[model samples]
Target chain A: MIAADLAPGAVLSLECPTITRTALALYAGASGDHNPVHIDIDACRAVGIDDVFAHGMLSMAYLGRLLTDSFPQQSVRSFEVRFTAITPVNASPTCHATVTDVEDGHAHLDLSVQLPDGTETLRGRAVVSLP
Target chain B: MPVDRSIIGSRTPAFSTVAERGRLRFFAQATGQTDPVYTDVAAAAEAGHPDLPVPPTFLFCLEMDNPARGSFLSDLGIDVRTILHGGQSFRYHAPAYAGETLTFWTEVADVQSKKGGALELIVRDTHVERDGAEIATLTGTIVVRDPRAGR
Candidate 1:
């Protein structure tokens, strides 16, 4: 149970919940990240953005699920992400993991959250202990 | 206008928050997490956790528990309207669980201006501790675009 049969070249993926206006609202309140750019259309327009977008943290949270689903939560030693693009509302994001290295009882993996159109919303890395 | 480099090294007072179950479950639901261990302690215990393990990235939510969270930006005359999240990272030295009281404090690690001063980014490192021992560190970048920059 401590290991996930992972190897240096293994690839893992999971489709996350499609982002919607309702999901944005719920996240805004629950995470206390009430950035109006994520929930209010008028607010988005005020900033010249045509439509509200998903919070970057929301995408990062979904990416975390990829790790949890594959390995035990406690096994995750580090997680990181760079916000590269905006995830417009209604976009379905997919989380991906590719093992880059396995050593010293841990697996180092490259991670990403990408949209259906192939836009990578987030990219980064993670280190997880196998034992 | 670029963010003043002097702001680097500014630190926030240490604050504390409890990882309550209700908020954890709410966050889990909001993220569309179907895993029962994140919501049910019994399931978490069955999974060998002492309690509901703090889901990855949830600590960022708890980091917002710093009561003066907004002061850092507000005090700098930065309009919340012009801000965006650039990127962030986390390193966990130990697993955090629900019901544990964790203390958090942040320091401005660096400040930079990019895209010809159209964007200013503030890098912060937040330290999360429990029982006086460090459990996690979160590094985040807050981007503030000059509203007048006109893209």
Candidate 2:
């Protein structure tokens, strides 16, 4: 567990489970985001997309896990993400956080989630209080 | 139809909701959160929280508690089917716990047309509060793709 003393260039990562349609369905129910394009195959076809894709929030959740895995829950001052691309069903997403600056008991991080196909699905930043 | 830039300064009526434990647990498990602090009240207290601390980005879900959530788009004559999640950001002022009634008020912060009006972006800023105290601020972007553009 990295409890501060982290340099500006410190890097932390989390390998999320291979996202599945079942997971997406559960996430929709749990998060209450029932957008059919995320879970319904027909909706995807109507939009010229072949299959349902993972929710952008799901990948953001994984990035949260990465921070919680290293720092205390309270230490997480803030987290935010941009939905860059869709994480299609069955795609494996890896979350990465690189510390860009450390100051006054906080560390600012550059965050991202990427698939193996070289697609960066989500990009974001976070601020964590240092111990 | 292009988004009305006049809607940029509009604010949604405030709405509130409680972070029920059962749903919090469900969300934790669904997101593969290994930390028990999000589900186990005792563990959370030990971690210096009065109760289960709301997970990161969970407030975005809570924002949907705005029963008029879809009304914003409808009022602007935008079809819900033409939208996509563009992006989101959050800044926490304090840790919110399960069972606390959190209030949300959102403002349409910005509106933009891109790709020669083929796509429109609506940016929203939501203030998360509890007992009139700031809990967090969630900013999200919704992209509206013009179904007929460039066709």
Best by DockQ: 1
Best candidate per lDDT, number?
Answer: 1
**Tens digit per residue, CA lDDT, model 2, B7-126:** 889998989999999899999989998788999999988888998888887999999768878788788887666788899988888888899999999999999998887888999999
lDDT of each: 0.89, 0.87
Q: Cα deviation in Å at residue A19, candidate 2? A: 1.1
lDDT of 1 by residue, B1-151 (tens): 6788997998899999999999999999999898999999999999999999899999999998677888788888887778888999999999999999999999999999888878989999999999999999999999998544554
Residue A123 miss distance in model 1 (angstroms): 0.5
| Model 2 / residue A7 / CA error / Å | 1.2
* Model 1 ranges off by over 4 Å: A1-4, B147-151
Each model's TM-score? 0.96, 0.95
Worst 10 residues of 2 chain A by lDDT: A1-10
Model 2, C-alpha of A51: deviation from truth (Å): 1.5
Q: Please state how well chain A of candidate 1 matches the true chain A, as a TM-score.
A: 0.95
